[model samples]
Target: MQEEEPRGWRPAVAALPAAAAALVYAWARWCFGGAAPPSPAVAVAGGAVLVLGASAAYALSVRGAGGLFGALFLALGLLSTVAATERTAARAETATCVVREVHAETEASFGEGGAEKTVYRLALDCPGGRPGELKDAPSPLSRGAEVRIAYDPRGRLSAVPAGAARPWKPALSALLLLALAAVLAAHRRRPQP
Candidate 1:
C-alpha cells in the first residue's frame, strides 16, 4: 500500500519570523518619528533578516498555497519596510515656509458609525523661492502665516508643522501585518490531508 505524505502547517509556522521582523522594523521607524532614515548598515541588516526569513519559509512550505503565502508575506514585508524607511528619511530635511493658499475638502464615510471628515491642504512659498504643498494639514492655515515644513533634500514637501504628529505609514504597516497573521493562523488550522 502507498503511504500518504504527512501534512504540516509549515507555511504558517514559517511566516511568524518574518512578520515579527517587520513589526520590529515598523516599531523602530516609529520610535524615530520618521525624522531620519535608517543608516545604511541598519537597512542592509534589516534586508538580510527579511530575506533569510522568507527563504526559510519558502524552503519549508509545500509547493502550492504554502509557497504563495510565503512569497506574499515576503513581498509585503519588503515593501512596507522600504517605504517607511525612505519616507522617514526624506522628511528629515526642514524649512520655514509661508502659506500662499489653503484648500479644504469634506468627505462622507459610509463605514460603521459613518461621519463627515474634512481635510485641509496648504500651498506654501518656502525659503529660497521653493514652492511646496502640505497634504492633510492638522489645522487650517492662514494665508501668509509662517510655518515649518519638512521635506526631502530634493526640495519636495514631506510634512507640515514638523513633528506635530506621527505619520500613518506605520499604522498601515501594522494593519497589513495583522491581516497576514490572521491568514496564517487560519491556514494553520485547516485539516491536514
Candidate 2:
C-alpha cells in the first residue's frame, strides 16, 4: 500500500499547540507581573487547566504532526505554569530596591563571528540595606532609580524597574514554544513507524 500525501492543513493544525502555549504563557506572565497578582492557588489552578488542556490536545492528536506539536506545547505549558507559580510565591516576598548605579558596557562575543553587544548592569541597595550588583538589568534604568525586586527566602529571582512589568518570563516562554515547534516540525518530517 502507498502512503498518503501530506495535507496542507496539517501544518496549520500543528501550529495550534504553539499558539495556545504562547497565550497561556502570556496570560500567566501578565497575571504575575500585574500590580495585583493572583493568589498562588489561582495560579496553580490556571496551570493545572493549561496542562490538562494541552494533554487532552496531545492525546487527540497522537500519531500525526499535531501529536508532535501537542507534546511540545504540553511541555512548554507545564514549564511556564510552574515558573508562574514560583513567581507568584516570590512576589509575595518582594522588596523595594534602590538603584545605586547604572553601568553599561559594550562587549565583543567570543564566538559566532565575534559580535558586539551592550550589556546593562545595575547596582542595587535592596531591603536589609545590603548592596549588590544586578547583572543584565533592563535597559533605560539609571542611577538612583527605585525598582522592585522579587525574592524567595534564599535570594533574588527578578528585578524590574519601578512600575514596569516584567517581560522575561513570557518572552522566554514564547521563545521556547517556538523552538519546540520548529523541532517538532523537523521531527515530523522524518520517516515514522
Candidate 3:
C-alpha cells in the first residue's frame, strides 16, 4: 500500500476543488448550451466565476499551496474547455479536397533570427458542394493536390486545414488536472514527521 494519505479525510478534502470546478463548469455550459460561442467578455466573466468559486472552496478547506495550484488547474481546464467547445462548434464536417490553385509568396520573418519564409496560398475544391480557400497552407501542396479539410456543412464555418481544431483536448486536460489534484491532496495530508 502507498505510504501517504492512509486517512479518508485527505481524499475527501482534496476532492472539493475538483468537484466545485466541475459543478461550476457544468453550470456555465448549461447557461450557454449549444449556441454560438459566448463573447469574450461573457467567457471571461464565466471563467472568473469558476476560478473564484473553486479556489474559494479549496482555500476554505485546506490552507496551503494546494489552493493556488488548484485554482491554476481550474483556470487551465476551463480555458481548455471553452477553447475546445468553440473549435468544435465552428466546424461540423471534414472532406478530402483538391487544390485548385496555389500562389506561393515569400515574406520576411521578423523573428529573432532574420529569415525569409514562403507562404503557400491555395484555393481548394471539395466534393462537399462548395469550393474553399486556405491561406498560409503548409508546403508540398500543388495544383490538384488532395488535402484534408474541415468545415461546416451548413456553411457556417469556412474550411480549414485538418487538425486545426481538436474537440477532445479539454477532456484530456481536465482528466490530467484531476489526477494532479488527487496526488497533491495526498501529499499535503501526510502526517508530520
Give the per-residue lDDT of model 1 (tens digit) for 1-193. 4435445455455456456556556644543444554665675576666656654555354345654674566556555655555455536567899999999999899998999889999998887765478888888989999888766554333564677545367647845754564456345433354
Q: Which residue runs of candidate 3 sit more than 4 Å off their true CA positions?
A: 1-12, 20-40, 83-90, 94-148, 153-159, 162-170, 186-193
Instruction: State the lDDT at 104 in candidate 3.
Output: 90
Backbone collision tally, model 2: 0
lDDT of 1 at 106: 95
TM-score comparison, 1 vs 3, better candidate: 1
Candidate number that wins on lDDT, 2 or 3? 3
Provide the lDDT at 78 for model 3: 55
List model 2 lDDT by residue over 1-193, tens digit each: 4555367645654565566666566656645564565776786687677766765665454446646554766566557644654444333455677888888999889998999988888888887853365677667487788777654433333544434444468557746765565455434542354
RMSD of each: 7.1, 8.2, 7.1
lDDT of each: 0.61, 0.60, 0.66
Model 1 worst lDDT run, 10 consecutive residues: 182-191
Clash-forming residue pairs, model 1: none
Alpha-carbon runs more than 4 Å astray in model 1 = 1-13, 16-87, 155-157, 165-192
- Please say which candidate is ahead in TM-score: 2 or 3: 3
For every model shown, the clashing-pair count is 0, 0, 0
